[model samples]
Target chain A: MEKTNIRTNKNFNKVSDIIESLTINTNPDSVAVLEEIGTNSSIDEVRELTSRALVKRNEHDSLQVVISNRGKGINDMSTIVAMSTINELLSLENKEEAMRVLENTISSEGFDEEVKENARSVKALMALS
Target chain B: MSAIEKVNQLSHRIFNTSKNEQSTSRTSNPFAASNFQKNILTEDVFESSKSKEANKVNFTGNLSASSKRIYSVFVGSINDIGSRISSGIESIKAFGSRMKEGIVNTCVNTWNKIHEIGNKEESLNGTKELLGRDITTFFVNKREREISKMANMNPHMEVKSIFKDALQALEADMVQVA
Candidate 1:
């Protein structure tokens, strides 16, 4: 068991370094690339970390990717990753942009009911905390 | 002449020896006995030195006034040594009390530290403010905030370069994992 942990630690550290690099990229297109790779990534941990990175960006474009994209961010089938993204949204220093995106997702008829519901819940949490 | 007479004679010799010690030395007197002969002459071997020092009358069977003065001086020296030993015992008792004081002070300090550790009011305050986030989340958030600041400061930075940098980072990760 200890040996397995040691082997996985190296891979975990490698992922962390790459994730840090993703957050370091400053261009607007990085958000789209992040949404594409983050939402579609097979690994739940990657999706979770990437979703958080997007929310931390706090830009309208980055906020929309995590808040409205299908099967990504708040819409992730993985409850754990979706919750992680919600927690990040709630924790943002400036909630104005994220709240606007959520209001759009909730009011617009284009989003799935599930995604809108997640947005409403996140909004409620933001109001509470 | 007899056993008792010999003892009396020896004491008489010692008494006169002390009285006229300036002029009549024991070694110079032809009749005075050696320490070895004194031992042989005494009934018990251990009796020689101590019993020899014990006061005996002069040839007249009465102690001289000068002899009493010498005995008093010897008793005074013994009393002085005994008092010094008693003072040493008193000092040891003082040291024991000082040691006890040091132990009490250490116990008090440890008790104060324990109370400081048990204080929970600050933790409760932090919980109310949501300042008690997990350490891993705190570090990740701080890193993302840095990225946000960089993006805001360098508006001219290209989206193409950002993708290129991210692709390079992923490729490096794949190589390492492999």
Candidate 2:
């Protein structure tokens, strides 16, 4: 494993920047950046930034945008990010709607079978909830 | 006998007798040419009977009931086997593709998680001094809304316990950092 150093102030500034961007305007690029930091950075603050951004995004964007972004296929990082964000938010509540999205993912011809199976697992998890 | 009446009787006998003679003998017309009568008979049997025999063979009504049933079952089984083989191959292909996808995603997720943790561990190295109050402030602010939502909106005990565990981890982090 390759270890990389990120200064504490730099991490704080990046998190602040992400929070600022998420609060002010959430374009695809901003969403992309937050997701990158969340998945790549070792800092919990950065992941929290991503979590917060997703919450903000869920509030600002339409469900169609979330679903469309998710259905763009799983090969892209953005799609994974969108999926994780949607999954997190939908898991909080909205069981029926989440199940609907999971079903669409499972049944749609475009998604990878593994991704569909992952969605199935998520659906099963939701059922427990 | 009158001359015209005898000629007419001779003409009827020759024409009628010639057709019957053509069936019985190869040389039916002794003087009028045997090949012409043979040609006519060949055409009548070959062209007419050929079509009649073909028609009879084509109609299933000519076949026995048991033979017809056997033929029907044979054709039906061939169709059934063809469809079953095709569907079986399709499902196998689908299963193979799914296995490939699962392996790929598993590798990808593992790689991402490992890299992220490695990077975090690297950053945290020698940072035991800077973490206390700063980390406390971060988790406290970040989790407040989430914890409140889980406590209020959702009534499930499992969900509450999960949130409580997460909150406990944050508090543990806060204690370590502070």
Candidate 3:
């Protein structure tokens, strides 16, 4: 039991550190790393945390990673995680930046329809609020 | 139809899924998005429940004749539910692409489709609804329900309050832009 508890705590701290660095680290490659690993993790909890961290950073680059990626961020396979990400996006203090990213995602012809449709959902919710 | 096939048929109706048809990609038909759901996502509800055997009900107590008949009917229905579910699970697994995110995506598509059809009110006349609530208003109410569910699952998250504010802000007057 003690071993399991320590292992769990260590994992939790590791995830927290990742999220903290993703938000505070100003390097462009930092966000790139987050997009590649954090969002792409098969675990729903990891993907959800990455999404929240990106939304919390409130930057165009971070927001674009979550909004445009397939099977990640708002496009998560788990409803709870996806909804959680959407909730975080809506809770941002400066909603305009997220709105800008979502708008571009919607109008861009490059994205898959699934991505665009998901973006459209976020836009509708954002528009309402 | 075979009993399993019958059960599969009933499962299709219960899950609101296409019968034996692989769900077309959202790109093919924008409206086919909400195709995945809860039962499809689970690993094996029947097998898990069977192994544990915790959910089995005991109806062995002495009872009057009429009461026993009612109990028999209840037991039959419960057994039917279990069988129908097992068959449905198999059929859904056959459909492939059992992504949980598809559940939310499908909801968005259907919700948007209703509003889109309501806006036209021409060529199709699909705006007709039963309860006198406009399509947009109906959609808001549904989202409100969803927000409540999400909130319960993750009370730490702000999912519920954000959606509540969105619904209240719209006041059901705002139609979703398709």
For this target, which candidate reaches the highest lDDT against the unseen true structure?
1
Candidate 1 per-residue lDDT over residues A1-129, each given as its tens digit = 232342345444444444545566666666776676555665566678778888888899988988997888888898988888998988888999998999999999998898899889988899898
Q: What is the TM-score of chain A alone in each candidate?
A: 0.87, 0.48, 0.87
lDDT value, residue B125 of candidate 1: 66
Give the alpha carbon lDDT tens digit for every residue of B1-178 in model 2.
9999999999988776765465545433343334564464332333356567877778676777799899889889989998899999989989988998899889989998999999888778647536866798787676554444433432233332342343345435445555
Question: Candidate 1: which docking quality band?
Answer: incorrect
Colliding residue pairs in candidate 1: none
| Candidate 1 chain A worst ten-residue window by lDDT | A1-10
lDDT of 1 by residue, B1-178 (tens): 7999999999988765643343334333433333454342222223344445563433423556677567667668778877887788778878987887798789878987776665566557677556546666797687667545544543235433443455446545545655
Docking level of model 3: incorrect
The complex in candidate 1 yields a DockQ of 0.05
State the TM-score of the second chain for every model: 0.25, 0.26, 0.21
Q: Give the Cα lDDT of each candidate.
A: 0.68, 0.52, 0.67
TM-score of chain A, model number 1: 0.87
TM-score of 2: 0.27
TM-score of each: 0.43, 0.27, 0.39
| TM-score, A chain, model 2 | 0.48
Full candidate order by DockQ, most accurate first: 1, 2, 3
Given candidate 3, what's the lDDT at residue A41?
A: 57
DockQ, candidate 3, comes to 0.01
